[model samples]
Target: MSRITFEDLEALDDDDFTEDNSEPMDEEEQDRLFSHWQSVASTHQVSIPAEMAGPIQQMTRQSNAREPVPFATLSRHEKLDEVVYEERMYPAGKWACVTKGEELYEQSISMAFMKLMRYICKENSAGRYLGMTVPVLNEIQISKDGKSFVRDILTAYYLPAEFQQDPPEPLDPDIVIVQREPVRVVTRVFFGTTTEETISRQISSLWELLESTEDFLRDTYIVAVYENPGIPCRRNEIWFIRRDQ
Candidate 1:
């Protein structure tokens, strides 16, 4: 099936597409359309106003309403004598991941997220419905140009405890289940929708704040979003892996 571009979605008319006489699309069709849109949106980059970010937020909220993936707090500290970041340890766990080479961080996220969403929603070898998990984690590699561009993004969803022992295989070849080892990271919290500019600014701020005292991997970092995109005061975070870990 051909992919649906962002322009196509914008061109669609609700009245014409959802006419009273037309039959509703089947679950399979719906999933296919959603996945296609996500694939297309991942390549399309644009700024979204807070009001216009609702639909995307709603989609994320529905998927993340389930229990959050567990993690442990190893330590907390202030940067430059101010509360800036924290250190945390996440245990080894299983995750469904999709990697995309996209120019923009947000675009890669939108695309990868829908793909992973399909897997947990029953597009797997077991055909079992594995519900969603909170705080979609995105590992992003910054370009050598000094954070001016993004090379790629690895979007991951932690598998729920029920399926962690024997997670189903993904029907999509691009999606995979992998075992992650425990690791320690330094993280900073932010709010609202994440755009290329906003994310870059946050990374720079954190980098500068910790530059003098900590040793961290500068090439890549993790972007974690914990709340529904549509809600106000949403929680988002940027995590830097500690080099000593």
Candidate 2:
């Protein structure tokens, strides 16, 4: 297997991964894109909820005006093989989101991710085309099966800096753009192809690394994946949110 350097992963952030944002996709093109995305999902064994199979509602319009939101980094511990621990701060901003299984607490994170992708791909009400950003964030939970698995996930996409003030609304009733408060986080960078086994290992290592820290209050963590499926090298991060003392 080819090795993916951390530097390469960092470079991916600067790469353009979306269509022209100056003009949103028209209704017909939006439907085509959604249909293509659905076909891709089926090929991967992922299912799109029925409500998401059509054009999404747009509660607001995109004037195409944009202001860059500041994106920053953090401090890290020495690299321990594939895992590197880091402490960082994040300024909260607007996020395009889809959350399910909150009441039942049994929702699949994959579904939320699919729905959010739909919003970014111009399926939402305003037919906006938002560029893809790094670190697709997932609020993770250990499955009912325990530490051996991860489930009950909430997935989100960071709205591009331009829409930080008032993001275009999601057409899917279950999807919305909400502002998240600023937070301090500890993260472990996991480099490699992501699979359930490797992710579980990284999650365990994250807990162990956290346990060794002093004076840091932590209650939960999330996984931030930084690669597309076809990418040869990938960078996946497990983020532990620090609590207020």
Question: Which stretches of candidate 2 lie above 4 Å from their native place?
Answer: 1-44, 47-71, 79-83, 101-107, 143-151, 192-196, 211-219, 230-233
Q: TM-score per candidate, in order? A: 0.71, 0.63
Candidate 2 residue lDDT tens string, 1-245: 12434345445532222232445667875665445435434433454565664323221122123223344566767755543677877787888766655332223555676677677768765676675666777775665546534434567778887667868888779887778888777877777545456666876777776655544433355777775432335567877777672
Off by over 4 Å in 1: 1-64, 78-83, 211-214, 228-233
Which candidate wins on TM-score?
1
Residue 4 of model 1: what lDDT?
44
Please give, for residues 108-174, the per-residue lDDT of candidate 1 as tens digits: 7766776776677667888866766777898877778774656578889999898899999999999
Worst 10 residues of 1 by lDDT: 13-22
| TM-score of model 2 vs. true structure | 0.63
The per-prediction CA RMSD against the true structure, in angstroms, equals 8.2, 8.0
lDDT of 1 at 150: 68
